[model samples]
Target: MSLSKGRISLIMNRNIQKIFLLGLLVSSTAVFSQIQEERLILNKKREPEVKKIEKKKTSVETIKNYPPEEKSAVPVEYEITNVPAVSDFKTSTIQGEDLSPKFDSELQKNYFRLGYGNYGKFLADGNISGNLQNQMEVGANVHYISTEGLKKEYPWSSKQSSAALGGFLTSYGESGKFNLNAEYNLIDYNYYGIYALQPAADVDLSQKTNQFTVDGYYDFYTNNILNDARVKSSFLGDKFDAKESNVSAMLNLSKHAVQLPANGITMNADLGLGIETLNSEFAILNKNYSNYFNADIAPKVTFFSGNSYVMLGSSFSFLNSKNKNLLTTDEVKSNKAYWFPKAEILYAATEEFKFYAGVDGGLKMNSYASMLQENPYLVSDQVIKPTETKYNIYFGLKGDLNQNLKFDVNAGFGKVKNILLYEANGLFDNNATLNRSAYNFANTFSAVYDNGNVSTITGNLQYYPLANLTLEAELNFASYRLENLEKAYNRPMVKGTLGAKYTMLDKKLHLGFKGFLMSEKPTNSFQIVETPNPNVSNSTIYQNVENRNDSVAGHADFNLSAEYKVHKNFSIFALGNNLMTQKYETFKGYKVLGPQILGGVKISF
Candidate 1:
């Protein structure tokens, strides 16, 4: 029997379910045994009941009084208890009366005009009050990213060094009934060098990249109508690289209401236009790869009700380019349209439980050839086709049982048609051949977790036994099949994390400890050239090689932080991460930066 990737993933999900059930059973059994023992002990110490008293003397005394009472039965009797009379809890007071007249002047000048108004009135009044507020932030980081293991795998040694400087400034203002806001940010990244061995010689290469963005927004409202507009743009450039730019603008209009409905519904729509351009020297290698411009306009509509919501969105983009490369030499021009239709339904079953399900799908124009042509290093002489399509369907449930317990489970399936892959040939050939290469075409596969044929199950639990303390644990399991030579290979990856935190010094100090465990067996596929049949059609063969380094590894991290308030406007603090200096990899073959120690003071008003 042959098992498909989807089937394999389903089987894995079932196994995880079984494991969860077994764990639940064990926990329930322990709790049940304890309850039974407690009940038995309580029953062993039962108490006896007592009986009570005779009325023979009272009957003799009542005989004479009954006859006299019958003769005077006409007299009415009334009884009153010595209890206090009920009083009204509600108080009535005259309106428009000043309760605190002594502070009226101060309230009108400082509190009423600028601070103590209702939220909406205060905000609107401030907009017309002509006031400006500015904020600025500046910080620097010294980062080091090394690929030591990656270097060892290749023919040369490599290391990543980064010294970054970044900052932002923002300002806001109000004029009459209008408000304006603006901000700017800048960041730079410089790479020292990359050590690698090319066929000609060993070389060291370096590059630098800088990015800048600016944004602005204006909002104004009058009577029942509101208007908002915004503009944003970003530019990125790198040494020995092409520059890219993105600019966009949007405007919105809506109506205001004096009082909103208890069961409210809102309908909002947006129309926007944007342009993106990319230019680079790398485009010279492939005529099909050149500077190109894309213009797009999109409209989105969203509807929200009590428990149901839907969104419909679509975009049409036009591509324009002049290619000097042979593949794109035909004056590439194309128009593409995309659309998304999605809806969600939610039910509140109880105070502690809720259920939800959603389905979202979209149509996208896929360019297989354009993607391949852009990456010259992938393979030689590859022809990519444009216009592929994809669709996705999903259903899930999410909710919480109590404040300390919560869960979410979702399953989805997606498919891509006319996808692209690569095939390669050795030594002098620069082009890719489908027969010589293991994968050379745009291939389509069902969408699973992490772009592989995998099913993932994740869950978390939290317990808080004391105030200012918390303990949390998380677990994830993934089962998938790696395809090679038209066969399915089963692989599983499992990861877990457990952590606890304690707060002290009136929550000014915090301490935490965390541990992580991960295990996985990765299947590697490669193509090898047969020595004797170098010219034969089947000279290259694809095989799945099992990497034996699948082992469970774990490490613990300890962190401590303390904050001391010097005054209302100023404070000092000490923070430490990875205080234990434990040796571990944040990921496979990637060693973590051991420990960092820093202290700083913050001032706020």
Candidate 2:
């Protein structure tokens, strides 16, 4: 369901892939003691009316920011549009369950957390906002987290921090509503992953990243169907000197009635531009950065009858890019166009079961901000390509098996023009004149793309076996056929999540457990071999034995959390993650902080 938090963005291909992620969100309803998590951003297309912008906490300290109970204070849409985006996957230590309390509607709506754990882990997340006048409000939030390296084995340090913070303001007039926000994200991290089987110098394992973003949106609530329009722009970069800027504007229009077979019609379009830079490593084949302009539109018509709905739509995109020739200094320019179907059908054949099927596809633009957030320790000179789904055809059955249990299962197949994968950077010759990137040495990952066909089987289950008890589960299995790569590097064949909660003492004391499970993943390994150099003296020549096939053992990490409400506005929680002490890796070689205990207080005022 969660696919491990860091694994989220990488698998975000539309249609079947989208189904792979959406089922997990729905299964969350089955497992319940009462989940009080307030968060968003990992999936943006689903929230169209709200125009979700993927609020990244700017601070890595939070595995999940804005404790859920507090979300009521600010319109969830307002909260999402202003937050820049979530921090990168930083080999973090706290993938624990949310033990935050679920309060009554009368309680205050602001929430805060302060936690500390093993491996020198520290985190603090809080925010304050107030209504200034009639419909004007101002708010500011703070997020900070720091953790030390895993000291158990030999290789390198995984020390890192998601140190970002910012503020926001919103106002509504007689005509429309608007919100504005700005944030700065500062992250310090390491490239600690090197196979113990093949060790290298510690090298300077540290890396620093600085990024800034100013984002806002204005919504027009008027009489016509042409009602909502929004805008977003951001600048993302890192210590590697990699830089990228993105700007976009979008509009949504919808209307129902005044039609024959089709009762409703809706359409939306987005136009954007990106300027990017990523220096090339000659050995890896120089890939000059591409700056591009793009535009897309999606329009759909809906037909509703009884308890069923059918919709038909299509997606169209246009792109113009200027790229330096690969493996050469010459520049190349190109223009491209893409289109896909967006049709869906739902039929209510019985009160307890429904049949649903769809064929959906779209384009996924990649940027530095998005790529790094997906995997922070990426090679600076890596190429970023936008993935376009040709199509995904799926069908499923979903409904209540009983009042206490519900389930949805689906299977699908699709082809994508550019599906991205995370592979270990190729090791280069030691005698080369090239000044290697910090992410080289096989310690960091690089983004690679290939054309591929994918088939996925996914399911979600939610059940309430007893009063005050909730349990949730989601699972996905996928198989891929690629045109160029050996395997879908770091992509798991099986992924899932499990969660359960129990409340006692009149709901003042809560006990909960949550777990993330990922199957073994294939990877690339490297070793250095020496050969006799006839041109040199007696010294032998060293060569990189690169891109060897390998794999990371599959493992599961479970966390437990307990919380007690001390007063109406205060509470204490004790959370332990990696309880199984699996010592697992969130990425290829970077082992996450595990078997940690964090005790903290929560406040609302």
| lDDT tens per residue, model 1, 1-605 | 00001110001122221000001110011110000110100011001101010111111111112213322222111111111000000000000000111101111111111111111111000001111333221221111111122232233222222222222222322321221222222212111111111221133223333445455554442212334556655555444343445455655444322233645765545555655554323322242343545565666555555434454666555655434456553655555554444545555465344455544443322221222212112222222232323444455554434333334444545443433332222222223322222112121011111222434455555454454555656555655433432221113255555555565665445454444444532322223232333455745533222332332144454444444546644445443444556434322222333343334444433
Candidate 1 lDDT score at position 401? 43
Question: What is candidate 2's CA lDDT for residue 603?
Answer: 84
lDDT score, residue 567, model 2? 90
After superposition, the stretches of candidate 1 with alpha carbons farther than 4 Å from their true spots are 1-163, 167-207, 215-232, 248-332, 361-389, 400-407, 416-502, 512-605
lDDT of each: 0.31, 0.57
TM-score of 1: 0.47
Estimated TM-score per prediction? 0.47, 0.78
For every model in order, what is the number of clashing pairs?
11, 11
- Model 1 sits at a Cα RMSD from the real structure of 25.5
lDDT of 2 by residue, 203-263 (tens): 5666776767666666544413554566667776656565677776777664443235444
